[model samples]
Target: MAKTAKKIGSSAERLLKVTEALCAEHGLESVSMRDIAKAAGVSPSVIYHHYESRIDLLMAVFRQRFGMLLALRAPLVAELEAQAVPDVDKFLYSIMAPIAFMRSKGEDGAMASRFIARALMSSLPEIKAEVDAGIRGMRETVDIAQRAFPHLSREEICWRLHFTFGVEHMTHWDNERLEIMSDGLCNARSVEESITRAVAFAKAAFLAP
Candidate 1:
């Protein structure tokens, strides 16, 4: 019984690692059960024993990424809730700390961002809810800014709030694009620098009118 239990646990872990590896390499569409099992050094039967279908495995990858993303940014939430960076601009970037964490890392960043983009395009309702809720938090940040500076109209505040998230989300590719655009002339700069420039530019754009 002990040996059997240990084997089962190990198989589960290997299955998970294999799914993650496939996602890292080719995103969801390219990964199949046979491919995952082969890369994991297990049989397709083993994957089936653990998961119902490829969709199940796909959902698992989405869940795992979503959980890690939340875990990465949880500290930032605590800091802001504790009022660490009260300035709206810093606060804006601070909210996207998880993406910055990904950018600071290498393949981990690429995998995370691509997985997120794919998940965004996925039709799974639960995953959609998670993504939507995560995005909706940007509105809360705008509300915070409004509380801090109450002179702006509600529409102005809401639009600026949504714009901040758009800026941050779009900047996820800044490093990837910089590499291509600069032809290796410019190295990957700091996420902070990007955040600073984005937030400053956004503030100018929003507050100017």
Candidate 2:
């Protein structure tokens, strides 16, 4: 029985991996269960056995990736909360570091990052609601941000955080646009540098008058 359960779990994980890659390479809306099955070397029926529908599978993928990110950020966030006063830079870095770590993971990591980006723009209402709910649950970090900038209205803080998300999303593209714009003087590829610059940028934005 344990072996059977293990086999089932492995098959589901393989389908998720194949689906993530396909969704990242193509767009989430373009990838079908048949595509996933073909890529995973399984049949459509097999996918159905594991997932009720394409949306269900996509949600599973989102949950898996988002859960990983939250797990990585939890300790960082806790440490910040333990501080007498939250450092703005450290507060932002706690949020950004997990994402940077994921992006540094090579092909699989890149695929996860792209899929996450795509998920954020997913048109399906269910997917959007799930993503929104997950983001809402991470309000602890936002609370830290609120403490770091008591002068900023909660609404303004949220807007700046939204912009911060945009910056973080752009980094996943790895296009080196910054390098081109700066005539190769600026590189956006270093994870530490990216996080530092993003933290500084966000700090300024948060503290803007």
- The Cα local distance difference test for each model comes to 0.69, 0.83
lDDT of 1 by residue, 6-45 (tens): 9988887667766776765576667788888788887888
lDDT of 1: 0.69
lDDT per residue as tens, model 2, 1-209: 99999999999999999999998888788998888988999889999999999999988998999888788888889888998779878888886778888888997887888888788888888889998898898677678878888887888888888898777776646537887887888768788888888778877777778
Quote the positional error of residue 29 for candidate 1 in Å: 3.2
Assess the local accuracy of residue 131 in candidate 2 as a C-alpha lDDT between 0 and 100: 85
Clashing pairs in 1: none
* TM agreement with the true structure for every prediction: 0.75, 0.92
Residue 87 displacement (Å), model 1: 2.1
